[model samples]
Target: MSLEKLDLASPDLVNENIEKIAALFPNCVTESSKGKAIDFDLLKQELSDSVVEGNKERYRLEWPGKREAIVTANLPTTKTLRPVREDSVDFDNTENLYIEGDNLEVLKLLQESYLNKIKMIYIDPPYNTGKDFIYKDNFSKDEEKELLESGQTDEYKNRLITNPDTAGRYHSDWLSMMYSRLKLARNLLTQDGAVFVSIDENENHNLRKICDEIFGERNFVAELIWQKKTGSSDAKNIATITEYVIIYSKEITSLAFNQDEDAHDNARYKYKDEYYEERGPFYYDNLDRGTLGYHESLDYGIPTPNGGLAFPNGRTKKLNDGWRWKWGKKKLEWGLNNGFIEVQESSSKDCGWGVYYKIYLNVDNEGNPKKRSSPYKNIIQGILNTHASNEAKDLFNRTGIFSNPKPTNLIYNLLKIGSNENDILLDFFSGSASSAQAVLKANSEDNFRRKYIQVQIPEPTDDKSDAFKEGYNSICEIGKERIRRAAKKIKEETKADIDYGFRVYRLDESNMQDVYYKPQEYDQGQLDAFADNVKPDRTSDDLLAQVMIDWGLPLSLKIERIDIKGKEVFKVAENSLYACFDKGIDEEFAKEIANDSPLRIVFKDSGFKNDTAKTNVKQLLKQLSPETEMKVI
Candidate 1:
């Protein structure tokens, strides 16, 4: 989630491809004294405060910590959540995604591939109701820190059921879990994006404060209230029906919410009965009292079109206060001619003698739809058992995957109000895949291309439940089934040919080269560099792809490979990026490549045969192509 600033022209950047770098960081680049380049350090500092320019100024930075700390030993956790084989569940190319793993680890892994790409985040984490399990999330143990320092991905550890009802420390566990996850989720949000968290009364207040701390209090949006259930016929101590959704943005004012349309439902605008007279069925009050250009002398003796003297109460005098009719006399007369205005006869003392205007039912001009304000009411009638049951039935064929599922209508309305069709939606606590289903359904119905990423832990199912009896073995299984069925139903209904498929990315041990962790000195004489016995599981090409994802590079970015002398070199089309991860590269190879003028060129630290040769290569490349960037992978 850290934002790093980059300088395409810096010596650290081996690639001198200015055009390609500009394309990668479209808005972050500026015309500096040298040329088009990025301010990497400034970008990193802004992330600590806020991102700017519609999320375009944001970039991923290295994790913060002491750079020279000693490495520690590593150990494996005794308790781990295992994943079941999902061979049976079918996943089409749907935009919705679901993963089973600890969300913190998943977020770290995703940082290499989906950083700063997500636009919206929504989660319904456990309310810490004394029974809830707060993930222990201690990733850097002393031993693990050593392993990471020596180059390795750390295995995480977690704990459950630590919230004690009377410990007065009950809020501590929930706050810790939420704080870490919110920090990670904030990284995932686009600069012009936000997050919404659903919670009951128990921890809503506590969660709001933590969110404010992470996203900044200035970015806090509205706290939406949703009625979770209908009122019961038999009540005890008052039924708890509503829940709250606390919202915040990565950058204030970047995200947009739909303004409500005003309601012009007034009974005075309705006609009583028609056909009684040419004026039609009309109700009238004093028009002259609030009319424009009124004089006290002209108040009582004014003439009506019907040849009747205007009543005393129908005063044409202007009041000291700013009271006046909205329309002028010509407009009032036009309304009378159009049978919309009328004069009341024999009006009682309290009813007054002023003329009233009849605003017709389907004929009045309502103001802009965007001018409406959101209504705050305690009861939301849309929440009912039938609604929940029907949504569950549609996703799981009435088997009822989970009992405490939120109504789709609730999430649906929130998405409509707080997000756009093209926004990226996320659900870190995706139980029963309700949020995923809601996103697919919403997109298909609205002809929008909204995307979603859902994360779930493959927690085992209860043996006594129907899901267990029906061969549904785990929560993740139920989630996969729900997504499968939802996609099929949406395709059948919409008949729209779209990529409903998701790129299946599973979390595993890093696909990095093992040689990256070997000791500096190896074997008898130590003539050759030490390399891992396991060989490299991830190639340099793979690392390049991972970096692309980390830097918020598009998946479809064009890349090409060229052969210089006897070595294979990669060229990124848009950035004019040249990467040489190959080892034992000589000066002739570097010079020949530099002759073609690459804007940026990256070589492996182990690529050049010697330090003198490496220095010569950089010097030659710089002299030949002055604007080219050079770096070592």
Candidate 2:
């Protein structure tokens, strides 16, 4: 059978689960009056005692809008991402992305293509400080119509609403906003992926509880305390100097952090000998142990290098009734044979001699010293808030283009620990585009190809603010400019061959017309109105973009245009995908494209010359490359 047009709507997860359960237990699945649904009674019977039933007491984080938040996440949106080539740098080649929209809608639009793809997500969301602007998602309202009516949008039509402490649903509104976005973001993470969220004391506890519920408590990595400043003068009681970075992994066992070695770690390995030079320097640890109880196995003594008998001293008493060597007999013997144990003369009056275990510098199996490094600790100090503000000033060339932008170094360190070369890093709350700058800087330093996807709502700048006066009307303007300036600065400074560019995409209504959504509502007379299925305002590039998303292809893929006969063909990622939205596409054009043997292809349904041509196109492709998947939109 030939392929049909992809359903552009977001996946109905509830129905998907129902079908999955129906597959496992057919008896439990039945058609309800509303439609197909799982019979919970039957399912419980099938599961027997294994399933927990009823409204029993359970450990869960609950709030006023928790249920609505879940519904908002599951509800599909007809929104699409439109490419803005004008706001982009190296649009055709760059793997980086900067998406301007409500993060909740943007995350949902990204769910398909980026599912299980992102290696790391770092977000500095609003900390709910009573004055912070929180996203208000009105699922009931039409996004496009709402923006048009408000008249507050710039060219991109991005909008936001503030959440003030005076509102009755202050905490509930903030929680609701974060809950849906976080839920969708979890799906985009790779199995080894990790998410880092920055927040202050304002909602740290609440954020942690919700994160526990969403990411599972077992995947919780660490709660890092970042010293934002030496101290804050605005504190009422305790002088709060630190904020937190809550880290969680998609899968705890699959995740690992890159260790960085500081001067202090290198100093730990002190002694080096010619024999152990290949293994690097090492330090000695006393082999004596003080025991609270008797242990028969570790009570033995050993012969010293000076022909002296050294008795085990437990440190509590002289070599008499105390415990002995820390290592057991077998390990002690192995260490002695391997030259890992050393005997030295005792300087202390309590013991005759001291036994030492040589702890060598961490090394690989090849006897080469491992990368000098230490595991990332929970406490992150030395980074100051002033450093972040100064970074903003330097980038914008204005005193206050953006306030309190995160230091690029801070994000760079986080990226170094959580990701590697060629991995994708996303920041849905990419205020000031700090993570984007950090990604570029990191890539330049390490000669990597890591990509980033940054999303920020175009929150309006206050008229009296310096940023507004400096020609930035919204937060997104500052973010885009920051990336542009940062990319240029990095290229000039490092001269490294890195992708110092990003494509810009803005969230908007789907390119498909209303007829495509509600085909059953129209009659044959009205069918003429939908001769061109795509919206009139949309370009061929816009339709191609939606096709890319519909097919779960990366938006960063290289696109090239070529003429086959008189019609233009769009080739994406070489031969990974081909789309021709032009009308009157005939059998000859289809054959010309099939000759390229693309993995997948799409075309406008009405673009075909006729039904015969359409059938011929399918047959020709099947004959040429039977494995090729073809779809018509």
Candidate 3:
């Protein structure tokens, strides 16, 4: 009856993938240092038709750090997201999330809850333009303090070296950074989901190949050419006015992109019908369509004005040639009776008479209201950098705050195409949170409650930058403020009752003490000092947040705190989980919670009076709610 300790760490993506593979092909699974891992050689043999040999030439997007990137993606992070209630907006009820941290670690943390849950992903990562950016192509851990002392890395350990084209690993390092993120991002997509990545001329081709490798070549949706400016004098030879938004679907079979509803050709519906209000207009098409191989049943005649039946192609029933009625016998009868058929005297001597069936412009024969939509074009224009700057000016009443953050309109367009009602959208490289505002704006117009998660690294802003001067010390601050300002502006303008708030969480080290993860590394005296597995600085809220993540519960889920016998208890998403972190947790509290039949239960191990008390609490829950999964931290 001993309660198991909750790992309370980011999911081990490598182990999870191996377990998945093991479930499909059990023979490929083997023991490794990590325990329960895939034997790649065995897996290859299982998958291949012939013997798999040494490194063979194959088509793939490779880079110097590709192996490291893949390893980094598979590595488990001990980082956990702690709720920043002070920085949050409507922390208790809001569906949106604004996570602050390095996106790589943040992506790893999110893997547990958000896997296959996001409907759309939009990212505007650092464009690697050899300017102010992080993750420099050149650096070493051994020179870390020396590098920082010499102004190489920032306080947050973000390498701030200029990665010019002359650098040995310019493209390789950028690709390495992007490859791991994209690898993790691909798992967060729903089957019908797609990712839209914004890039310039420098890396669009490389990104295309990378996406093709990750999302599969067949899942490549489109390379949308967005006109960022009318023209740019900064360009040397050809004006670099355009950029690209490359899209790739999670699964090609499930991906069905939306179309432009307003762009349909309205003029084509020139003719009206009795069903105009329901089905709109009507146009006639020949009922007797000529066929290469006519069926005998389709060659039958329709009743004419002369009381004699008119055969197909003026045939006298005895003669035959390849011709058939577009509508079947039953449909022809129904169409004629329902005012859907039109009969007229023939212009040609061959047929002599003609029969036409009305083609409704909007709805089908069943009369369900249908939409005529124009295909979403690959070329996006009119959404420009000036609009984005104007938006910054309008929001902050200043220009050059974010150096041309994406216009909300651009992401709004993407949302319309890739997502709809109640769908979740994510942006890992969420600078200025344009994607967040887009979700809010779209929901207001469409009345669809589309939620979003915005993850941004708190990259420090330049001292001379307007954003830094305006009291926004970092890009995270700018992003948070933009959402706040944009929410107010959009709400006032539209007066829409949409979610205008987000829960803020900052990524940090796990809430557990080091001895909890590695007891072997600590001495008996050190272990004695760490009787409480949880970190001293961490709060009950922090513990709850980590437990929620480790339990694979989304951060957006509703949490209700209630006091049971002078002890605080958190009930997440109505019986999804129940946790009590207060001291002196006894059978009395356990029985009360067990009555509600929670799917999962957690308690701080130190909360119990002793080991016997912990056993008693576990036994109490078992008798009351046998299905409840008990865990401790």
Candidate 4:
């Protein structure tokens, strides 16, 4: 049999890695109970004009648009924040969320609701130090399709595997793992939003390139060089001293930076002149002939203070470097009036007939007066391992488990520059959970409502290691313990009603999908008829619940079901929700459902028998329930 070439541009490339097995290869791909992979062409037809495309994949996503996206001005509501337990991941009223899952999958699920909503994101992913086991994520198009079609949904649930140095595809492995996740994470940032990734030398270079590709090169803010340690090691050929924090923005023009004014250089103000203000201190800086008022012939066309012409040599001459307005006349007048200007004293031999303008401590907060000459170069003072060891000892009540945990101050200072109080900070490769500690400490110090979402795979700790033997079996357990300790400490210090709690949302099999598909044996016609509505492992209700959770809707949202002309219709609120997942929807049932005037109505794209029926249903619903919004599931 001849093989047909697949369209390279088509999304089929996403999961078609497996080679052809037999003549019936296409039919071999089956559908899962959760409906993981359906026909992309069909989905595109259903969600026209709303599909978001990347280099190799297209995601059918929608949003409420700019009207609802805008943060409107309103009277500040009298609200006291609290840490309430939410059974689902909506995060609901809380500003922060703590989700315990593989960030890759979580980020994919978040693409719909959180697209362009995040302002700033901070993540400390695995450094790939060659020792640290990096995540091995290989979710491909074929695997996804197979999982869906077979009604077997555990396909994506692979255990974390170590990427050893012997692995030839180390860079490819790390890139593949990060590529899709970063692609999804990019959607969550606003146009002007920014992201900060923390990495050591191992993958810093790679990360910079990846971020440039994802966020665009011009949008790169800076690659900060932070001294994470003070001491030099004697073990290696060259002592590595710093780690880089890569920063990028969704839109370069939308970036906002807090200007940090530098301390005045006291050496520049050492000239002897007596003047001090009560409010603060003051100093006199000298002016040279090149200053504004120098050549009287230029502005006033008059003579110099020594009595001849304004220009030197008793004749007009060009000013040095054609300098003008070191101090304009109006500013010069103000300086003289305030006793800030000083002409050469009467008896002084080196009296240069030029004017001096006062540089005062008080200056109006206006235009970019001084552009930063260089990036921030302050070497962050990190805590010694002794200090870190002691802190970890206290947390574990013994010698620490991890050897080189970063200090809390190092992360706190980095966070201070980019993160605000209400930001949702994510730490995907949260080791020892120092980032979490920094977030809590910063929140308490400033009373900002910043929230943190940390994800660490349950990689088992070494059984021979002291940390594991001490009862922390996995790295995740240590991470959780660190968070608990950090919260307790923060609570003790701040008497405010701050929430030191975080909800743990772990990655598990989706409740809607089951492992295996076992359709009851029946006639070919019967199988075709029932297959449209009856899933092998999951029911329609399960998929609906998953959709609701993914949309950030509350799980406790009351669901009501009603029967209309032998078809089941689900209503979430009294008159708010109306979902008809029932395939082969009769025309009369559709009309009856429309007459109820629900706020929102959802129907599976395949539910209607034909395009004419779908059109009629949409047309009638608009007339009867004019205010109701319609959505295709």
Candidate 5:
């Protein structure tokens, strides 16, 4: 087989699914002359009445740019994440990632490798307050050239603008920006994964509608109310002290809420009995039911300890009606036989005796002792914005570096419920990297090896702000510093053997030169001028990054450089992949690599000594390791 270049872009999911279906049922799949277009008519006919088509009145949420939002989500990006080893901590070993770029583009770049891989995502996107910065995705134009010409970008090349309420399409612009990002983010979630988004009253309703459309209304988990603050001094009418966190699951049926052990400890299971030593604490619940609208079968009187029947009555005993036990006859008999029902003399004259059901704290359905815990509640309380602000101030040693930073505890609790040990957590809108700190702290506390990927745009800090004055030109700088500080603090405090470092990557143009993309337009003279397909400034590491992206390999995998026959060869994730991009590669070097029999190997097309040497290497690899998939860049 001849070696071919791998397309370095996100896969077209629709076409991939079509190919799978064709493989399973060849008769149901038909192709057209226009590059294998699916014959929908035959496919539908094969399925008979199992599918619905051409429904004009279907339910869907829409807005001005809804269609464009979908197009943006499907569009492939030519951007790649370039490693910044100088800015990274433990670059060779850490599984954590700190990606500085426009999150929309970053999410698209991550689609291939991270598809259905992330366990939980927690994003604190801009609440769309009038003064907050909003992203404007100009998909119609070249992003890099447009930003360079618009003068809206900082030295780091992050394109952003303040979105005021007076903007003509205030709501529409914000909605469009969120829609595309959310759509792409959903693809990275595992089947049992979930996402939590933080918002306020300004766009809570719109965000809910957008999530309903993207994640499917059936997957809507809960709308959590967080008591962000105790008071709002600048209120016009009502003092708004709460914000919302909308939760959605990839598949609701597969998601389960983790139990809160601390909450279970404070439960009111105070009663003790003869079996308390074995059954643990117990609580008494009322067994009597109201007579009004009561069923006759449930109205039978319950026997009292005083040899009398208990009946339902008003406080003054003005109306005496037949009483009903909360449990049916068989259940009551079971409870009585198991000593779970108790009758005691009542203090009130209205009822001579009280019937009660015993609920044991550590008991199973069969009334045997078992450990139990409580499910976390939707309403999260006691976490205030002031706490988050204090944390930011303490971390930065200054005030106003970042505003309204989320508390690490809040994100820590969310991570606890949404993720398990070793699962991947993502936060695309990672302002100030609070989620990163939370992940680090959680891993240390629980002795877990969980991984995190944080994406944040290097939005320029205000010139007069404290952060800018402190040498932090962009929010990304402040976020990266926070992670370093948090990692050091967590290590010193916990002394845990957990990963407290992250790998740093920045988004940029693909490593391939422009000529590589438009090879057909170049004449022989032009092609000869561009001998190397890769860009001039890109290093061997940059080319390897693109290779990983094209091959759908995790970017955090361990990479090592080894000398083979006095030529440097890069090995990634052990034997998973090997590459040699050095010049003057000979048959001896190629044969040495072939003897290793790696799963995959790549070489620079121009690095070989001659065509005869390349042919010799290929033949040797085919004979020695026929199973190895080899490619040339």
Candidate 6:
């Protein structure tokens, strides 16, 4: 039996949406010339409670390139990630990933492996300051001089098409760029996940509108004000100092962030008792409290230290009370039996006693320590932009390597709020790799591991900058070096055991040749001209990586190169998948792999001796590893 060829491509969003719609309303789905499609007229009628109005005026955000941007999100990319072993810290073991590529294409490739897996996403994208370039520039294969002359890139071939105010479609272009990426990003968030975006005044309002449309207005969490600086002296009317960090949850009902850390004066809690070991320390307060209402049950008396009866505020009579004991009668008795209530002697009063209660520093409620946390405030301060620049300088040991890098503390704070032990954190527009440093630091502090995936475009640096002078030619180079250096520093200072390694993968064209995808357009003789389906320079590692992505397996999974009787084979995540692309295979090789019993396996079609050998190999696997799903390239 001829094995099925593995479909090496990203998830087709259009088809996935059709299947989802069909599951809800089957009659709204219909067959189109291309494939399965949603019948819009039927879908519209099914969604409406009354007669469907096809073209009524409604509230919706629109732009010139909106339609094209929506199409881009639904389309699959022809690119794949190729592993970079030399740059990777721990390629074989680490769960963290540092991907280098255009984030739009990278987001598409990750749609399958990371669908509903990422717990938190924090992106600091281009703020659209008219001088800043957007990420929508498409790179072409022209010469460097030609690209520079056409204003598509800079001297270093950096994708730097600026969107100045003079351009007619200024906001439209920015919206289109953000709209498509946000649409793709939402699918990757877990049910309890959320995304945070930072923006300045230049495009804050526009970004809010886009996020509202994408994440739904009801799911909007908070517009946190980050005091980026002390003040901007260059401002004409008012000094600008704050920026907005908009947040939205995937499902508002399911998500809940951690409360802020405890903020209290330790000195106040000074007194101690026998229970101080668990309760920390204590302070005393008057036992009597003014009543909000006249509850006669609460107005009770207590026996003093001098063997005297002490009523509420030393009142002997049960007058219509404006005062009462803070605790109820049962709770007051429990406190008296415990070491919580304090009765002291007085000179003049007939009761001759003072009643007070002990409050513990670490609260002891029914013999349990209360959780130490407070509601987090929406206004963030003190972490300034200068701190971010200073961090870059400290890490690089040189100035001007990067400008306006986000402070690692900011991400550390976000990690506390949004992540827990072993939760996945992602930052697509990772600059200077501060988020990676933050995750590493957070893990070290608590010894709770959290895996992170960072994505960035390799935008080149200016020649005059200190980063370029130090041989860091691109932003990705600086970002990667930051992680390496930061990991060492964190390990030395903190002496905390944590995972400080990450796998590196660079985006590139697919490993397959043109004929592999377009065999129908070529004659059999023309197809015969190509020696193999894969490209000439591609290696077994390259094919394995792409195959894992196509099979919806993570790139960070543990991969082992097992030698099966001189044939090179890759066993991913201990038999979740097994692949051998080497040639010269027979039933003996298939039987060896079948003995291990992998859940899924793939091989090169040309690996077998002949058609007869391929048929026997499948038959052997059927008898030995019946559960294995076999495919070929």
TM-score of each: 0.55, 0.80, 0.81, 0.54, 0.78, 0.81
**1-633, model 2: which lDDT tens digit per residue?**
344887776666667778899899998888978688888887876876676566566687788898888888888777788889999988888989999888887887787889999999999999888888777665465666766577534455554556678889888888888898889999999999999999999899989899998999999998888888877788799898888889999999998776662332344567986776766678777776554344766766677777766767724233446566778778878778877888887887876778888766766423345665356642255777787788876777656777777878788888878877689999999988989999998888766799999999877788999989888888888899999998888887876678988999888888888888888999999989888888889988888877888788888888898888888888999999988888887778877787789999888888888888888889999898787898888
Query: Model 6, 1-633: lDDT tens per residue?
Result: 658987788888888888999999999988879988888988899988889867778888888989888887888877889999899998899999999888888999999999999999999988988887786533445555676778776443445567998889898888988998899999999999999898899889989889999999988998888888887779999998888888999999998787654322343568877755778787787777552455788877787766667766666656665776767878878888887887777565674566788878677636567676556653255788788788877877766787578888877877778888788888999978989999998888756779999999888877988888899888899999999999988987875668888999988888988877778899989888776688989999889989988998988899999899798999999989999988877898988889899999998877787889889988899899999999888
Q: State the TM-score for model 5.
A: 0.78
Residues 346-427 of candidate 3: C-alpha lDDT, one tens digit per residue? 8878766788776676666655666554577532657888898988989988898886589888998888878877899999
Q: Give all candidates' CA lDDT scores.
A: 0.58, 0.81, 0.83, 0.57, 0.81, 0.83
Candidates 2 and 6 compared by lDDT, better number: 6
Tell me which residue pairs clash in candidate 2: 261-373
> Residues 240-299, candidate 5, lDDT per residue (tens digit)?
989988999999999976666433222456778775557777778677646224555665
Q: Candidate 1 deviates by what RMSD?
A: 20.0
Worst 10 residues of 6 by lDDT: 259-268
- Model 1 lDDT tens row, 290-359: 3234444433433466665544454434344333454456666677666655666535665333565654
Please say which candidate is ahead in TM-score: 1 or 2: 2
TM-score of candidate 1 to 2 decimals: 0.55
Report how far residue 299 has shifted in candidate 2, in Å.
Answer: 70
- Give RMSD to native, each candidate: 20.0, 16.3, 15.4, 20.3, 17.4, 15.1
Q: How far out, in Å, is residue 222 in model 1?
A: 1.8
lDDT of 6: 0.83
Position 536, candidate 4: lDDT: 45
Deviating ranges (above 4 Å) for candidate 6: 30-32, 137-160, 262-373, 377-379
